[model samples]
Target: MLTNGLVVDLQQKNMKIALIGYGKMGRAIEDIATKVGHQVVLTIDDPDFDAETLKKADVAIEFTTPQSAVSNIKKCADAGIPIVVGTTAWYNDYNDACDYVLSKNSGLFTATNFSIGVNLFWRITEMAAKLINDYDEYDAFIDEVHHTQKLDAPSGTAITTAEKVLANFGRKNNWVHHENGIGSSTNELELSVRSFREENVPGTHTVSFKSDIDTIEITHTAHSRKGFASGALRAAEFMTGKSGIYTMKDLLNE
Candidate 1:
């Protein structure tokens, strides 16, 4: 344990974290890990990587694109390293990755958005949806904004919010981007999720529940990407001794 701003015992299962991507998010993870008494042993950024170098790491935190994230997880699994992945848009292969991890007895955790506040917001949003389900008085909509560099529209956070809303409300069978101009006429509750990309915006997700009488809106705006980075570090630390496929919900609930 860390005490008085010092890592007292270096020999006591010191976790060697490997960063799979060295972009802005990776740098922020390094900073937070250092502050939280973890050591970063390796950083891999090459397009063609070597699994042998990554074998020295006890855990790997990946925050790369969809195309590269799955392959990175595969490499880490082959190297016998537990992994916490924060990459989005590659969820089609998520089940396969989890299967491989389980087969190898290695831990794997993933989150769409790794902001602590966002995770908490998601919990509250779910509770609100359940409470408002029977009311039929409130209509819901979700909006998300991210940096211009973000490739995915609507964002994983927005998708998660829609899922939570759908769980409580029978009206929504699926979510469609508002840009598609799909009108809601089935009296089925419709959630219109819109996405925006601007300069340097880390992330912002707003859930608006409205009625003819009043409107209740909950918004989680990230001032920086540090929160995501910090949460990823916590996930990496949490995955060190575990063997399973987990999500931020598991972390928050625990």
Candidate 2:
């Protein structure tokens, strides 16, 4: 919100938020939202939730599964509510989802990893990839770890990191998932993303540029869900008074 040629600090005022998906992330967002002077007006856990209730708040934050993310976003858009989505493995329909949200004149904020540190790490990865692209002696790889309960392998965070590296690192053709250090990649042009699931990991992602002499690495480890929650709150704040699809790029740039 540019008021008087200055960005409005949305966190300065209270916001009424509706939470879609009352799981761990939902609870985390609620905790941070309230502590920062915002209100969680509603929480929806059921997939068969009453879609009309989403209209009760200034913005809605969704942390549901991939299977339900599109439906939930459409419902929020239908109800004229701005929404911030934190679900992964749902991008097969992302373009259509954006079209539907835009058609409804609703704002949608989406992110793979909603941690400020992770986003910064991504930027740094991009910078390093760009600088090393012409070196011809380096190859890129990613490793991501999460809690056992996490549904997706490689994680949305790692996926975004791969995208950043691939965009700048000309030698990499595509990203391939691996487990137990075995990627089965047929060619070197494929970037490897190794995935691990442990008992209680919040999340950890590392990007490395390797050569025979030495290796360069960057890592971001999440201590808890608080960073994700906090960033989601900021995204919700940014989505207010807006109507269109937005992402971490928009929020961070602002």
Judging by TM-score against the true structure, name the best candidate: 2
lDDT of each: 0.81, 0.88
Model 2 misplaced regions, further than 4 Å: 1-10, 184-186
Off by over 4 Å in 1: 1-13, 179-189
lDDT of 2 by residue, 38-151 (tens): 889999999998778877799999999999999999999999999999999998899999999999999899999888778889889999999999899998889998989988
In angstroms, give how far residue 196 of model 2 lies from its true place: 0.6
* Best candidate (score: lDDT): 2
Error of 2 at 155 (Å): 0.6
Tens-digit lDDT track of model 1 for 1-254: 43432323233245789999899889888876776577899988775989888878889999888899888888888888889998888988988988888888888999998877788888889888788777777788888888888877778888888898888766667777753223443444456888877788899999888899998888999888777887787778778868888888787774
lDDT of 2: 0.88
> What are the models' TM-scores?
0.88, 0.93
lDDT of 2 at 170: 93
Q: List the residue pairs that clash in candidate 2.
A: none
